[model samples]
Target: MTTIELDTTKLRADRLFQRKRLVGFAIPAVILAYLTYIFFAFDLPGLAGRANMDNAVTLVSDSWSHKVHVTRDNRSGEISYAVEGERKGRYPEGARPAWVTGDEVITIDLGGDHIVRYLPENRTEIEIPNFPLIEVRAEGRSLVTNLPDDLPGWISASNRRIGITTPEGRITLTGARTEVFNYFPGWELFWFTLDSPYHGQSLSKILFGERVDPARPNISGAMSDWWNNAMWRHKDVAWAIGETILMAFLGTMGAAIIALPLGFLAAKRFSPIMLLRAATRRLFDFVRGVDALIWTVVLARAFGPGPLTGALAILITDTGTFGKIFSEALENVDQKQIEGVSSTGAKPLQRYRFGVIPQLVPVLLAQILYFLESNTRSATIIGAITGGGIGLMLTQAIQTQKDWEEVAYYIVLIIAMVMFMDWLSGWLRGKLIGRKD
Candidate 1:
C-alpha cells in the first residue's frame, strides 16, 4: 500500500514538472520565432538602407536652429537678404546684416572659413576651408562652373545648377538665382519681423525702459508686432488652439448629454422593459464599436471638413462609450436610497432626481472630466483631418519640409496643451468630488 501510494504521488509531481518545463521553453521559443518572422516581414534589415540619416540629422538640427538666406536674383542682379527666404523676414530698405559687407562685390561670411562673394555680371566665388577656390557664372538658362570633373561629395554640380554643402552653411547656384544659407542657433524673428521697430529690443526695454516705437507705447507696440508676426503667426496659432479646445469641449459635453437618457433606458433599475434595455445596450455597442478616428473619417466625408465635423465625430464615438459606462454606474446604485425617496410619496421623476442622480454624480463627473481631457488630445489628430486647429498647422509645417523649427514649436504646444488639460481635469475633479487625499 505504501509503495503504490508513493509511486502515484511521484508520477503526479513528474507530470507537473514536465508541464512547467514545456511552458518555459515554449514561451521563449514562440517569442524567438515571432521575432525571426518580424525581421523579414517588416524588412527591418532594409530599414537602415532606406533611411537617409543625413536628412534626418539635418531635420533634427533645423528644429533648434534658423537659417538666413542671402539671395541674388541673377536676372535683375539685385541682391536681397532675408531670414528663411521669406518676404516677411526681408531686410529693411538700405539695410543688411552685419555679417554681409561690400557695396560692389557683396561678401558673405558664413561664420566659419566658408565665404561667398557675389561678383559683378552674374559671377560668384566660393571659398571653403579645405576645398579649392571655386567660381561659377550664370548665363541665361545655364550655369558654367569652374568645378573640376571629380568634385567632392558635398558638392552637387550640373549644367543648370550647382549646390555646395558645408557644416557652417550651404550655397546653391542656378541660372535664375544664387543663394547662400547661413545657419544660426536660435529662431530668428520669432517675436517680431524685420519691419517691426521692436525686432531687436530687449524684453526689459519693452517693459521698463523708453519707448522703442515713437508712434505707440513700448508695451503696446511690442505686443502688436509680436502678435502680428508673420513668421511666427502667434495670432493664428492661438485661434487654432482655441478651435481644438472648443472641439473637444463641445464633443465631450454633447456626448454626455446624449448618453445620459440612453444610459437610463439601459439600466435595469430604471427601465424594467427587457426589450428596451437590450435595444439601448445594442445601440451603445454599435456606436462605440468603431473608433473615434474611423468616425472622424466617415463624418469628414459626409459633412465635409470643419471643427464642427470633428466635434460630431467625437460626439458619436463617445456617446456609445458614455452610454455603456453610465448604464453600469446606474445599475450599481444603492436601492435603499431609491426606496427612501419613494417612501416620501415621490413620483418616478422625483425619485430619480433625488435618489439615483445624487448617487451617480461622482461617477458621472469623474468619467465626463476624464473623457474631456482625453478628447482634447484626440482633437489634435481630428483637427488635422477636418482641416482645423493646431493639428492642421502642424501638418502644414511638417509638409513644407523647410520649417522644421515651426513643426517643433507646434509639437511643444500640443504637448503643453495635453498637460494643461490633464492638470485642469485633475484639479476640477478634486474640487468637485473631493480629493482622495
Candidate 2:
C-alpha cells in the first residue's frame, strides 16, 4: 500500500535503464550487420588472386631458381633437381634428375645386389635389386668407393657427400662444415649443398632420376650454411666483430678519458664552485639528450663514411653518456674519504686521484662493459650509416634484395661476435672487480 503511490522518479529511472539496455543491444546489432555487409561486399578473392599472381611472377622471373641444386625432401630422398628446362624419364619436369646431362654423374655399386645409378639428368636413384622400398643413402663425412653397375652415370666422389646417386635412392651430404640445400620446387635439401657439378648442364641432363626417402625430414640447408659459415666459424667472424668492438672500445675508452676530468668538474662533492658544476652538468645533459642515430648521421655527413666516422659518432654519443654516469659515480663515492684526503693537505687532484677514482673505476668499467655490448649493436647501425664494416655489406644486400643469404650471413656473424664480447667482458669484470683470496 505504501508503494502503491509509485514513486514516478523510480519508475522513470527503471524505464531509462530498459531504454539503455535496448540501445546497447541495438548498437551492437547494427555494427554486426554493417560488418556482415562489408564481408560480403568486399572482393577478398581478388586480393588473394592478386597476391598469388605476384608471387608467381616473382618466382618465374627470379634467375636464382634456374640454378640446379641438390634437393632432399620427405618424399624424395637425397636427389638432384634441375632449376630450369624439360623433365626426363617418368620423373615429372624438375621432379628429380639422375645426373646432369653434361656433367659427370658418379655411379657406385656397394655390392649386396645394390645398384647406385647417377642418372643423366642431374639426380641419383638407388635400387636395392630385390628390395621392395627404395633406400636413400645417409649423407656422411665418409664415402665408400665400390661402383654400383646399375648406376646411371659416372660417379664423382668426396668425403663430403656433394653428389652421389643410385637407381631408386640418392644421398645429399650434409654436416656442420659442409652446407648445401635447395628450396625451390619444394625440395629444400639442395639449398646449401656443395654447388652441383651439372649446375649449368642442359635441360635434358638435368632430369637423370629421382630418389625416394620415406624417412628423414628436409632441413633448411641455407640456414645450416649460415650457421656453419657465420657462427661456427667464430674465429673468422671475430675479425669483423672486432672492428665493431674496436669502435666501441675506442669510443668508450676515449669518452671515459674525457668524462673523468669533466665529471669531477660537474660533481658537487668535488667541484664546490657552483658555476663550474652548472656548466659541466648542462654540457652533459646537452650531449646525452641527442639520439645516437642522429649523432651518427651528423658525423657521417660531416666526416664521410668509414671506421673513423663510426668511432667518432660512438665517441660523441658515449661522451655524454659517460659524463652523466661518471658524475653519478663520483657523487655516490663515500664523502668521508674526501674529508680524510683533504685533512691530509692533499691537493684537489691528489684527493680525487686517491679518493674518487678508486671508488669510481669499478663502476666506470662495469658501465663501459655494458656500453660495449650496447655499442656493439650501435656500431653496426653506425657502420651502416657511414658505409663501413659488415653493416655496409648488409645494407647493400638488403637494398638489392639479393637473396637473403648475405643478410643471414652478416646477422649470424654479428650475433656470434656479440656473444663473444659478452663472455670476454664478463671475464674481465670478474678479474677487475673480484677480490683476490
Best by TM-score: 1
Clashes of 1: 0
Model 1 root mean square deviation, Cα atoms? 1.9
Residues 197-285 of candidate 1 have per-residue lDDT tens digits of: 99887789889999778899988888888999999999999999999999999999999999999999999988999999999999899
The regions of model 2 sitting more than 4 angstroms off are: 1-98, 102-239, 343-345, 435-437
lDDT of candidate 1 at residue 323, scale 0 to 100: 97
**Per-model TM values vs. the true structure:** 0.95, 0.51
Q: Compared with the true structure, what per-residue lDDT tens digits does model 2 show for residues 1-437?
A: 35745787678889999999999999999999998888778966567766777545443434233323333332333344433211221233343444333335544443455544454322345555543423233334343334443544434444444354443333454322211222233222222222322222333433332211123212332333434442124333446566777787888788888888898898887788999999988888887777678888888788888777888888887888899988888889998888899999999889878877788888998988778777878888887888776677668766766334445657767888778787778878889887322
Candidate with the greatest lDDT versus the true structure: 1
- Go through the candidates in order and give each one's C-alpha lDDT: 0.93, 0.60
* Candidate 2 C-alpha error for residue 219, in Å: 31
Counting clashing residue pairs in each candidate, in order, gives 0, 51
